[model samples]
Target chain A: MFDFFIHVASIACLYGVLALSLNLQAGFTGLVNFGLIALFGCGTYGAALASGMGWHPLLGLPAGIAMAALLGLFYARLGRKLSSDYWGIATLSIAEIIRISITNEQALTGGAQGISGLPLLFAGLKPYDGMARLALYVVVLALVWLFCQRLVKSAFGLSMKLMREEPQLARSLGYDLDRIRRVVMLVSSAIAAFAGFLYAHYLTFVGPDQLVSPETFLIWSMVIIGGVANNRGVIAGAFLMQFAMAYVPFIKDALELPTDFVAAARLIIVGGGLLAFLLWRPKGLFPEKVGGSNGR
Target chain B: MIEAKDIRAGYGDGADILTGISLSADRREIVTILGPNGCGKSTLLKTIAGYVRPRAGSITFGGTDVTAVPIHEKVRHHKVGYVPQTDNVFGTLTVAENILLGARQLAKTEKEKRFAALMDQYPALAGKKTRKASALSGGERQILSLARALIAGPEILLLDEPSAGLSPLMMHEVFDAIGAIRDSEGMCILMVEQNAFEALGIADRAYVLSLGQVAMTAKASDLLEDPAMRKLYLGGEVHAE
Candidate 1:
């Protein structure tokens, strides 16, 4: 039970990072990034490639983030001419292209079989392996949470919200839209890639299947359910989602439901929950807080 | 001081809305641009504000050609302030934040100093400094917008239809605030308005635009007495204030 609980907590922390990252773009900056999975895949493949070459996971982390950043910049440049609606389609297509590339590139990515047995995060701390690993994840989560809080409260955060709410006004106020969009893409993608690096190391595996659209949808749901712009709400949303994702299968088993019905039921529940929330609480659990002069 | 000489401009691939229009405003003076609907009054102001680049001619402010300067660059480098006819205030932001948004480049001490002075000038806004700008009345929103533009210490202020969508009484109050700004700041003020009589009442000079062309340009007082001006633009009757 202790090991299982730790495992669940670790996974929750990992998803929490992803939720926070997506929230920074979709919630705070009002950017619709449908290609989060591509960035996540970049990080996973980066870590996998590095570890497969016998490099430490710590050394592999930056490699993953850099790859995600480069991809994000490319997307930003491409998205310049497209409207928001088209941008969404463009990002989704990009994610699909990245997944297809990974699937076909057998020589470089080990093909569909994937690379496995990557180095553990705390292989040095052998006796208390699970606890130490969980501790590391928790520490990273805390640092990210604190950093997000500080960011959203600062002048930079104000500029981001302004850009989201009033792009023309933000531009008139001297905020270069191109530069702001690029920076946001870079920052959020790097953060998501960081989470992916940890996930790949923890699972000791990397495969194209892990970069599916459903995984990205799960993160978006967490952000939407928690509250778009509120980081604390995002964390709470992640836990709620982690709980549902974990126990829905258990409930299905207890009911003796057919294996095919499991995926269908989970989708129905999540979709229905999102619809209900949109109708009743469009802003999510915590609405974006607009600060007054007191903040200055 | 600012000058626009024969600027011809329009939206992309659209016919020229501001066709060979020229105007100027000097320090501590108010220049009013008046026209009928679709006569390009707002477009002329937009051209001057850097929203529309002129296809010909040039705009000079502070003795340097600023025709090619972008809106944000004009604001940051040339201290050019602009308030759109509508959506002037940031609805989600508080009144104080709206005013302080332009003061981002100022030192903390200077920002506080300007905030105090602006509050003193517009007492009504000072009372609702902590409230969201959307909660303010239409007249109050106009005042808040003015305070915001003024707080930036702009050398040139461009206003588009400052009295649009306001009651006569509120309009009077808004014009009073504009007069106060001119008296206090001594900045070059250029305004585009449909409120002909009231605008001419405060303007030092007035230009009447007809079909994107300047039909009349003279001292405001001189145009107010001109019978043709009253007949063509001012509705042939001045409402009793």
Candidate 2:
């Protein structure tokens, strides 16, 4: 049970980082990034490819970040020509393309089987590796939270909210929409890639299955159920959802239900939670602090 | 000073909305463009403000050819301020934050000073500096938009239908505020307005556009007194008071 809690906490921390990344782009910037998982896959693939080449998994860090940055830039370039809804579709298509390529590229990515046998992030610690990894995730999540908090509170953040809510108003005020999109995408993508890198090591595997559309929806649900633009709420939502997911099987067994019910339970939890929040509390657990003169 | 010569522009691949429009306004002057609906009034203001690149003409502002400068560049480096007809204020932000967004590029001290000055100039907004822009009434919102543009200390101001959707009383207040901007800041003001009488009352000159062309250009006072102007635009109702 102790081990299960650690696992849940670790996974929750990792997804929290992802939720924060999405919050910056989707929540604050009003960018609908349906390809957010593609950005994460960049890091996983980078690490897998590096390990496949007999290099240290650590080397994949920079490579993955760079790949995510380039992808983000491309996404921003695409956004210049497309509005938000169309851009969302475009991103989803690109992510699907990336997933298909991973599935079909047998030689490079081990095809559908994926690349396994990657070492744990703290494997050197043997019996203590789980705790160490969890500790590292906690520290990382804290740092990311602080960094994002600082970013959202800055003048740039105000402009981001402005652009999100009133794009023409922001443009008329001399904000370069393309530049803002690029900056936001680059930063969010890099953060997502880092989370992916951590996740790949945590699982010791890189697979196309990990880059599914449902994963993106999962994070979106967390953002929505927690709070759209509120980081603390998003992270809390991450933990709440993660814990609920990690224990669905336990609930199924304890209830003497068929194993198939676990999957249905998860769907109900995520979808029902999202629907509940959207209907009753659209702003989520901790609503974004806006308009207070003190917001500055 | 700002000028557009023989400007032709339209929305993406459409026929030119503005055809052969020539206009200019100097500092300390308000030049309002009055026209019937779909006469390309807003498009003309957009073109001069760099939102639309002129298809076949030149634009110069403050002695520089700004024909190709984008809207953001015009507002940032060239000290241009623009207020659109609708959705002018950032609805989710405080009045002070909305104003400060316009002054983001300024030095901190200068930004604060300009904000303070705007607060002084618009006391109605001063009490609600921390209030969200969405809470403002229509007249207050128009005033807030003006305050936002003014906070930037722009030299070239472009307004699209400044009096749209306002009560008659609020319309006059907005126009008066605009006239005050010209009187106090010495900025060149170019406005597109449906309220011809109220606009010409404060404007130094006026241009009446008809089907993408300037039908007439005259001194504001002259246009106000011209019987032809009344018959064409003002419903030919009461004589210009």
Candidate 3:
């Protein structure tokens, strides 16, 4: 049971990082970035490719971040020509194109066979055996959390909120909307890629299948159902949804229910939870506060 | 000094709103553009503020041709300040932060000094400095808009319907603030307003616009007393003395 709890907690932390990164663009900037999975996939692939080349795992982390940021810049350039539903469609198409490219690039990415035996982030430490490894993972998660918190409170963050609420107003006030948008996209993509690197290193393996459309949909649902604008709500939603998905089988086993039926039940619960969240608390657990005097 | 010569402009390729319009403003003068709705009053202000590019003609500020300048460059070079009619204040920013954003291009020490000076000049903003702009009353927001504009020490202040959608008391306060600025700061105040009588009453010179063209230009007091102007532009019934 203790091991189960640890596994669940670790997975939740991972998803929480992804959710926070998504919230930076979608929630704060009002960008409909359906291609977020592309950045995550890039991170996973970049890290895997770099580590597979026998480079230090730490080197792969920055490589993944840089590659994802470049992709984000590409997305931002594309986003400028579209907005709202049109932007959503454009991004979805871009994501599909990226996934197809990855799948087809057989030689470079090991094709659909995927990459395996990637080095662990802290190879010197034993897996799940010592407090050091657990502590390191926790520290990584904490650093990501701190970075996100700082970003949301910064001047750039406030500017992003302004752009989201009213682009015209933001422009009239002298903010260069296009430039800010690009910067935000790059930063969010880098963070997502960083999370991806962590994921690849932790698992020591990755594939095109891991970067599928379903993974993208799952992250989006986590962000939207959790409340796009609320960071805490996003983290809560990530953990709650991931844990529920992972733990339902245990419940089914205890009850002696069929495994297939239990899996279907989990999907239904998740779908129902998403529907309920949208209908009831559309703003999530912590709605953004409105109206206050300017900062000092 | 600021001047617009033969300035012809409109939205997109639409008909020119300010056709062959010519206007000038010097320091220490209050020039009000009085017109009915959709008469290009705001367009003229926007054109001068560099928000709109005139299709033909030139805008010279301080004897420099600034017709092709971007809005921010014009703001920096010509020291032009604009207070838009709507969403002038950032809803999420505190009033103080909104003001600071106005002075963002300034040095940190200079921005702090300007902030202090403006707060002192407009005492009403002192207590509400830390309040978010979205939470302010309409009048307070207008005051914040003015405060933000003035913090930059702009040579020319372009105000677009500063009193629009405000209560009578708020309108009076805005005009009073404008009057005080004119009396004390020697800032060039060029404004577009729908309130003809009230605008002309306080303005040094006023131009009446109709169909995006200038119909009349004269001393504010003269325009107010012109019976034909009163009948055609102002309401048919004049305010009793």
Candidate 4:
């Protein structure tokens, strides 16, 4: 049971990072990035390819982040022409294109077999190694949460909030809307890619299937339920989601349901919770606070 | 000085709302544009502010042809301050933050100095500096917008419909604040106003636009007394007191 909970806690930390990254783009900046999983896949593929070539995990991690950030910048430039509604579809389509290409390019990406035996981030441990690894993961998560907190309170963050609420107002006050949007995309993508690096190394494997729509939707649910622009809320949301995901299997066993039925039930439960939040508490558990003097 | 020469502009593919309109305002002068609804008065101000690009004409500010400069560049490089008729102050930002948005490029000491100076000029804002801009009354909001723009120390200020929706006494207070800004800063101001009598009262010069064309251009006092101008554009109401 200790092992099971440590595994769940480690996964929760990784998802918390993803949630915080997405919140920067979607919640603070009002960008709809439906293709976030595509960027995550890029990170996974980048780190896996590097590790497969015998590179250290630290070097591979940066490679993944850089690859994802380039894609994010490209999409941000394209965003200038596309409205929000269309941008969501465009991003979703791009994710599928990347996924399909990875599936077809068997030689380069190991094709459908996917990459295996990825270099472990924390390999070679002693007694209670699982708990130690989980503790380290929590530390990393705390650092990321602190970084996001500082960013959200800075002047750049204020400009981001302004861009979300009133682009015209932001532009009139000397903020270049295109530049701000592009920078934000790059930053968020870098953070998401880092989360992917951790996931690839922790699991010691990475497959294109992991970069599916459900993964992206799960992160969205966390952001929506925790609080849109609040970092603390996002972390809380991530842990709550992990708890739900773990407990559903226990329910399946207790009720003697089929394994396939549990998968469908998990989706229904997550979707229903999201709908309930939208209807009852659109602002999530913690709503965004106004910035600047009034914000204090 | 700021000048717009024969500017033709419209939204998207629509017909030109401003067809070859030319106007100018010099330093320390309050130039008012008075026109009926749909006469393109606001469009003229927008064109000068670089929010609306002129198709065939040019806008020169302080001897530079900034016809193609983006709105952000106009505010940062050209020192242009624009206050839209509505939604001028950010409701989510504090009153001080709204003012500081334009003053970001200044040094901390300079920014604080300007903030202090503005508080001195507008005593009402001094007390409400920590309050959200949304909490302000309509009249106070107009003053907040002016304070925000002036905090940037702009060389040219463009105002659209400053007295759109206000009681008569509030309107008087807003115009008084505008006149004070002009006298204190010695900056060029071009305003589009529907309150012709109140506008012309403080304006150094006034232009009456009819159907996207300049119908009359003269000293504010001259336009006030001109019977034909009053009959056509000034609602033929009470003369300037």
lDDT of 4 by residue, A1-296 (tens): 77898899999998999999999898888898888998888778888889788887678778898899899998898898788889888988888888888887877688777999987655677666777778888988998888888877888887888888877777788888888889889988988898888888888788888888878889999999998998888889999988888889899999999999878877986798689889999889988776673221
Docking level for model 3:
acceptable
C-alpha TM-score for every candidate: 0.91, 0.96, 0.84, 0.92
Model 4 clash pairs are none
Residue-level lDDT of model 4, residues B1-241, one tens digit each, is: 9888888988878898888888899999999999899898988888888888888888999899999898889999999998888877889878888888889899999999999999999899899998989999888899898888888899899898999788899899999999988998899999999999899989999988888878779999898888888888997667634
What ordering of candidates by DockQ runs from best to worst?
A: 2, 4, 1, 3
Write candidate 2's Cα lDDT for B113-142 as tens digits: 999999999999999988889999888898
Each candidate's lDDT (Cα)? 0.85, 0.90, 0.80, 0.86
Off by over 4 Å in 2: A292-296, B238-241
Kindly list the per-residue Cα lDDT of model 3 for residues A1-296, writing each as its tens digit.
Answer: 77667767776787888888888888888888887888887788888888778887678778888889888898888776676678877878888888887778887788778898887655676554434445665676678777776777777777788788777556555677778889988888988897788788767788888877667667777877777766777887788788888888888889998879776977676677767778997877666554332211
How would you order the candidates by TM-score, starting with the best? 2, 4, 1, 3
Chain B TM-score of candidate number 1: 0.97
- Error (Å) of candidate 1 at residue B180 is 2.2
The per-prediction CA RMSD against the true structure, in angstroms, equals 2.8, 1.8, 3.8, 2.6
* Model 2 TM-score, all chains together: 0.96
**How much is B205 displaced in model 4, in angstroms?**
2.8
Candidate 1 wrong stretches, greater than 4 Å:
A52-54, A78-83, A110-114, A123-128, A293-296, B12-16, B53-57, B210-216, B237-241
